[model samples]
Target: MPTLAEQLQTALRQETAVAQRLYEVMAQEQSALQRMDSASIQALAQEKSRLLAALDQQLLARQKLVPNHQVEGAVDALINTFPAAIANPLQQAVDQLRELLFRCHNQNEINGRIISASRRSVERSLSLIRGHQPDAVLYTQNGGATRMGPNRRFASA
Candidate 1:
């Protein structure tokens, strides 16, 4: 059987690799959003889910080995549990993984906003085509809602 330190190293490596892959996937997703490629974005989302599952599994394995399963806490646990020789490298690996995962989060947030904006734009266009103003809401004197009139702008164009 491999030593605990060795196991920790292997797990760290696996987690780091998965984190890097996730970052790459997020980057590709950003591109797909920019290009408005629905199919590519769908495929990328599925791939990201799979990678996330794998990362979860890695975290489970790390939990079995370390007291603290969280990336930041796990590094400290590894340093306290193992020798300096093993702990130093593990710390670096874990730190890098954490950084990469953080980048993935930031990129995903940006992509999400872009997707939300695109969805709103599409909904507005559809509403206009259906003879309704998406952004215009009129209320009666008593604060009752009124039915929307046909959006004549589209007809005149």
Candidate 2:
């Protein structure tokens, strides 16, 4: 029985909460990456996914409450048309959510890069364990395949 603006404000507040949690998780994930803690990273990733799903639900709920949800400038239109008190609080929530989500994205990107680097290092280590240097391609001078390098024998294990 709440007004549309009130519903939207509530949804936006919920969205902001999810975004804030996601941002914290991403920050913790970055720390886990630095510490090379795969278990913590996995746990944080699951939590982040849950927060994202909740945020998506909040967005859909907000969209459903707004009449001009599909319009390009619906948010701006809504803000300009609503009362100052409602509009101001909703706008602040939206702004804070935007900034928190941005931070989450940036941190997630950096964590992805760190994970990629770690994977590469692990791959190199595995390659060495298997007696194959990553850069040492087994090929002859005439483009023929030949194992003429000092590499480990994987079959000997």
Candidate 3:
């Protein structure tokens, strides 16, 4: 069996890899959203979900190696319990994993914003097609400002 430090190190490395992949997938998802590619976005979303689950599992495994896993800074406390030779490298791995997870989180947020913007645009278009004028001022085909009565109908069955 591997030592506790070694197991934790391996878990961190696996989690880091998953986080790195997640960041890349989120970047691709952003591009898909920009291009309005529904298929690719759907596939990438599934992949992202899988990666997140895997990362969670790896985290749980790593936590099991720490005696005080429920306590704040428990991993750091465990790292300090080891000799410098083992502890330094383990700490470095932890830092790298932390940075990758942070990047993944930021990228996910960016993707969410893109999705929100797209949804708003779609809703606005649908509202126009359904004859529901938005509260904002409107423009006519002649490039002049115009406003329609609230009861005006743009389409009918």
Candidate 4:
């Protein structure tokens, strides 16, 4: 069996690839800007449309793999329902890994007693990670709970 870390690593790669496909679709749409030949433009547009749909499907499929939570229900459904193989299995793995990362993130907060002050920092950090606002944060100061997150917490300084 693949190590859990290895499996999760594969998942993260899959996730990044899906994001790259989104970028590629946008890039193809922008291709029309270079030259406006009707055929080439049409081709690029078609390709862009196809990629977007694929991305949407992939998103739905992987989201389904994550265990349910209120905010994540839609995503879970989407991920679960995606059909067939994506252009890249690696991308699918990444999506799954990213989802797992979030699960791990929140699990880290359990039993933590910051309640106010520094607590806001933890909540805000988690929010940002969940939103993919800046980047994905897979850890927190406190050791994780049932899932993987930062394995460290504030030392009793």
The best candidate in terms of TM-score:
3
What lDDT does model 1 reach? Answer: 0.83
**CA displacement after TM-score superposition, residue 48 of candidate 1 (Å):** 1.0
Q: State the lDDT of candidate 1 residue by residue for 12-87, as single tens digits.
A: 8998899899999999999999999999999999999999999999988877888655666655865677777877
Whole-model lDDT per candidate: 0.83, 0.83, 0.88, 0.49
**TM-score per candidate:** 0.81, 0.79, 0.88, 0.36
On the 0 to 100 scale, the lDDT of residue 34 in model 4 is 36
lDDT for 25 (candidate 2): 88
Q: Compute the lDDT for candidate 3.
A: 0.88
lDDT of 4 at 65: 45
Tens-place lDDT per residue, model 3, 31-137, is 99999999998999899899989888988988888887999999999999999999999999989988988888898788889989989999989888878875646
TM-score: model 2 vs. ground truth: 0.79
Ranking by lDDT: 3, 1, 2, 4
Shift of residue 14 alpha carbon in model 1, Å: 0.5
Superposed by TM-score, candidate 3 places the C-alpha of residue 84 at a distance from the truth, in angstroms, of 1.5
* Best of the candidates, lDDT: 3
* Cα-lDDT of candidate 4: 0.49
Model 2 C-alpha lDDT per residue in residues 1-157, reported as the tens digit of each score:
9887888888888888888888888899899999988899889889988988998998898888777789987886887788898788888877887798888889888988999999999998987787877356566579887553665354573
**Which is the winner by lDDT between candidate 2 and candidate 4?**
2
Query: Residue by residue across 77-156, what tens digits does model 4's lDDT show?
Result: 43444443532454456455566545433433321222243457668787555553333334545854333334433232
